[model samples]
Target: MQTTRLPHDGPEISVLALGAASLGSVYSEVSQANADATVQTALGLGVSLIDVAPYYGLTKAETALGLALQGVERSRYTLATKVGRYGDKAWDFSRDATLRSLGESLGRLKCGHVDVLQCHDIEHGDLKQLVDEALPALRELKAQGVIRYVGITGYDLAVLEKIAVEQQVDTVMAYCSFTMQDQRLGPVAQRLKSHDIAVFNASPLGMGLLTRKGPPDWHPGHETVHKAAAEAARICAEAGSDISRLAVQWALQKAAEQGIASTVIGSSSAVNMSDNVAALNVPIDAELLARVEAVLAPVRDLGWDVLPGNGGKAGS
Candidate 1:
């Protein structure tokens, strides 16, 4: 596995990271046994950065991840979990809430402190409070050695770009905007790299849009977006290939080219875990990738609003 270091005196991590959303059943219901197996599989494959959130499965993700990491050396993997956005629509970024959220996350994760503590879905919260109250609280936690680094995660590229370039956080993770079907994060991540802030691009499969089965039923993408993805999947299927493999490889290659630290994808099954790690070594066929990209051309950078009514990159 390839390795990279975070900016501003952070830990070195594997380029392919593990996302714990599936462990918490954010995408589907997963048994604790499967979650445990998945975590072990990720560690076995040298995936060092593990990203989870209190919002995923309403804090169940953190708990399950905590159980999975039990007895493992704390130094073996870099732990990251987010605060705020506790539910699908619940969001609070007050200083007290931020502090309380981390406290709860620490308890749920069964750790003294997390390596990376991020403000989750900042665009969904009051921007002013997030900048003033939530961030200051996170910095305080860092000062107290409760968290080694501070970061932010959001689906809004504009919001992430503004805060990542101007704020003091050590890293930023933007999802669903950096996949094979969406290349907007390429230039944005480049600009972020210039500022010495590490970048993490999550959901390289575009939150299921770039898969053979297509996006989930609840996906906020447009009908046209789903159709284009299905067409791209068909093109890959005809070539005896999986669209997800191509998506993961393309995103990983792009991350390396753009100097992004790691690409995070959630896996609940051990097979999926191993497959994702193996994807880094697989060669992406240029002709096949071009054909898939051509099929997805119409929906390039087309994203649905993660937080509807916020004027985000919806239908753009």
Candidate 2:
């Protein structure tokens, strides 16, 4: 239930922000009732930041969240959604498209304006366009009160750092790059922090690669990395803990230590949400953490290619 303040004069948000991709049914179907319960439970547990995107479940997540948030006081939590990348293959970050996306997102989320509006998956688009056209559009919206904070999200640490430093935005959400497996975001995050830009680390579970269930087929990690993750999960299990719990706790605690605003995570199940919050109270087992790291030593930071601009592999 802990919270962190966003740098650069942004609002305070929960250290454990709710990720809505699960409600979007990214890997599995999520019922409306379950989605509602998940959001409610997170709020009940004092989570104040709910981040979603139109691309998630093709707008299903936003709609579900809007319904759940109905009748609830809007000031109880901070909302964030993204622009660009409407589908798996569709991406447009032009000024017109960005504005249109924000309009559609506000409609789906049933909110007047988002506390944070970020450019979604910028690595998939032309970075030059994002800096040249998309960011200015977001800035205009921010000036118009449609977006309180302007930011960008991507997987490439180098490009993200470039944007974060150059754009002079409020925040950046980087996924799967700041996990226990890959602490590559430390330097880049520090640079952003120096610029008063808050850092939001998403997918601390490493896109399911750090869990006992292992990475799904769609996960870009190589087979060897998956095997290493399996061993790491087993190590945690042998210590009478679940990898998911360790993973989330690690990310949350690490972010807090680093002064990062929040670690974004997603789950459609209320039980999982409760369990994750509960894990925050449990102390980090250093020996257990070290053992898990040892198991993942071989493939540490060795993930499949997900970076843009160069089609290069990340966590290398």
In angstroms, how far off is 216's CA in candidate 2?
2.0
* Candidate 2, residue 247: how far the Cα is off, in Å: 1.0
Q: Candidate 1, 174: how far from true, in Å?
A: 0.3
Where in model 1 is the C-alpha error above 4 Å? 305-316
Scored against the true structure, residue 203 in model 1 reaches a CA lDDT of 86
Residues 27-114, candidate 1, lDDT per residue (tens digit)?
6799999999999999999999999998888888989999999999999999999887777778899999898999899899898879
TM-score, cand. 2: 0.94
Q: What is candidate 1's CA lDDT for residue 250?
A: 96
Off by over 4 Å in 2: 306-316
What TM-score should be assigned to candidate 1?
A: 0.95
| TM-score of each predicted structure versus truth | 0.95, 0.94
Q: lDDT of each structure?
A: 0.85, 0.82
Candidate 1 weakest lDDT stretch, 10 residues: 307-316
